[model samples]
Target: MNAKQIIVTKNSEEKEFYSEDKLRASLRSCGATNNQIDVIISQINAHIYNGITTNDIYKKAFSILKKFDRTFASRYSLKRALFELGPTGYPFERLISALLKEKGFKTKVGVVLQGHCVTHEVDVLAEKDGIAYAIECKFHSDSRATSNVKVPLYINSRFLDVQKHWNGNSNNGTHLKQGWLVTNTRFTKDAVDYGKCIGLTLLSWDYPKGNGIKTNIDSYGLYPVTALTTLTKKEKQQLITRDVILLKELYYNIQVLQNLNISANRIRQTKNEMGKLLHYDTFTNGTR
Candidate 1:
């Protein structure tokens, strides 16, 4: 099969060719070693077929990755796994809250606060070291969709209102308050421009390039519970609905899987996978 044959993407768009360089880059981005990356690329090249979907290619590569390193496979599957958190994004919000907590910030999900003029339910509120942040987490199931300018415009307005009322409240210990717009997808160029011009912190999948959401997730090893390949969709959904959002959380509380009626063998598999996924040394070199 020719690599230059058309391939379908997740969004159903057609690309004329598949580039080995691009695949290698993606593998490297997910912390695959040079030797492992080369092996994966060679395998992918050997299996290339006309009309192959990118999704299929990803699955093929992931299966190969799992054989070599389950941890790297989990990291590589982060984006797709994130999409599994949704239909409602409640799980994503919880995951974001957990990630912030890992960073030494006190976090709250689905917090409803009264602004100067109206009530706003912030997706995630993070407070640390006398600074409080009202974060709006926008999750997208579609890979092609972007968090656009209007979202920040609306969020900034709400944040302004909240800041006005909460400015002098000493009880909250908020010496400084800011608004952050976080998304699971990329940000539009206009959105980035607006955020930069107005000081709204926009953390999208790849908007800030080197220091985006994927970068943060990789840097802190904050893999979501959805990233566990051993767990079934129903099992993952049960965990997420019960607020078991982080892989680290599952690692420490292995009994939670028992509560969900997962089998002893599956529970053990989950633990081993989490061990690899959250191992600090595995992610140390990948941080930006």
Candidate 2:
């Protein structure tokens, strides 16, 4: 029987009997169909590890998948494995947040909300100096190196929306100041360029020595820390304050000029009336 079918039927004791089935079983557990497993088995010269533990079974499946096409090794596949691990939930958010904390940054997990059409709670909301930032986590499949698209653009749009909603102004001060797209895979050159042009920060993550997410700043194709500061919430607020003050001063100057112009026109009208009164008196008396 295939691993998926077996998984539904067998208990712990029964599962032990199938442990030594090797390639066929491991491939099935990794979501490969019988036909797919047949092709992979045909290519193998030999198989090692006569006795496989539960953990070894997972490793073996991942190892076999590395030999397959990359399209099958997407973020979708990694999430499926996380689901199969059990019901309590994979610590995907906590895993990334801990790494950020180690870097002397505070991280809040699952705070930002998207929309009803799309359900996404951001992995981390990092903050420093009263400014918040976003980090989206993607756990890549063991078989493939990391890669992605769309996240950068989505972040830009959502950021603007969040700013408009919470700040009571067009400026996005209450939301994340800057955006960080975090993933287990490395980013492509075009993605990095797009991020640089529009002020998005990309954080590439790797498995740490002990396990869980760790920062790879050197490998990460992020904009420099200097470039990202302007995108922060605090900086945006400062710019808003300066603009407000300048506008207020301009309005006050305009009001002063308007009042002065009105007073001068009134004085000219009063003088014209006085001249008309003097000319009427002389004409009525028949004097030069």
Candidate 3:
């Protein structure tokens, strides 16, 4: 039976036929090799059926991928990793600030600035090359939801208010250059169009093709501590509560896991996985 004909339910509650090409692209996005992709597809093809969910398929794939290697499974779990950043926006906002800091921007998270009309609490304020940005983060725990036109429409208005105030204030010789709406999820066509028309920058997981949140995070190897498949969800949250967000953060403080009462052997395994995930060790295609 052709898997393409098998109907599948997506996280968004949308139903569509399963497409092999989409699966291949997703695997590739995480640096899956051709042979590895072929193996995964072959295994997946065996169990697919009408009304099977994309999430279930993903869980199965992740389970198999982890047995091959934790790092590969971690990368394959990137989207879910972003979701793990929050039931709140603060961690997500801090993440964006960190990514901007990587790109040479001076950033502050949860900033309060005066708008022309009123005071606004910006999710993040970033400045680089004498250009400032009033950034608003739309962090969604729901992977299926996309930010719509209303989101950008509102962001543009907020930007204008802040832009007007910044231009008048001289901003220590820096002018507000852009307003950025960053989200972990995707944006709707109308949202993109409005952002483009008004000159607001709309950034999401896959926007702008080569440069996006996903691309930047992958390029920088800034996977969150939550991405460690070795850690349970509760353990990950424990790390988050202590302000340990990224894998790099955990790498430096491997001893912190002991505070959570994690086993010494499990901690060693996590440390080894972190080395591979952060590229501290050489990257390869097969199981370690």
Backbone Cα, N, C clashes tallied per candidate: 0, 1, 0
Q: Across residues 13-109, which tens digit of lDDT does each residue of candidate 3 receive? A: 8999999999888887776788988899899999888999999889888887887777888999988999998898888888888898888999999
Write down the TM-score of every candidate: 0.88, 0.38, 0.94
Question: Considering every candidate listed, which one attains the maximal TM-score?
Answer: 3
RMSD of model 3, in Å? 3.2
Provide C-alpha RMSD values for all models, in order: 3.8, 30.6, 3.2
Q: Residue 36 of model 3: what lDDT? A: 86
In model 1, what are the clashing residue pairs, if there are any? none
Name the regions of candidate 3 deviating beyond 4 angstroms. Answer: 281-288
Residue 195 of model 3: what lDDT? 87
**Which number leads on lDDT?**
3
lDDT tens digits by residue: candidate 2, 1-288: 343333311213234443335646545644466876676554332332333344544445455554563222222134332322222222444445655664667888777554323434666877766677777665554424444456677766665565444445435444447767765556666666777888877765433232322222212211111111112334323323333111112222333323334355543432232222222232253121
Give the true-structure RMSD of model 1: 3.8
Clashes of 3: 0
Q: Write the per-residue lDDT of candidate 1 for residues 193-246, one digit (tens) a residue.
A: 999999999888776879877888877878888888888889998888887888
Candidate 2 matches the true fold with a TM-score of: 0.38
Prediction 3 TM-score vs. true: 0.94
Question: Native-vs-model 1 lDDT?
Answer: 0.82
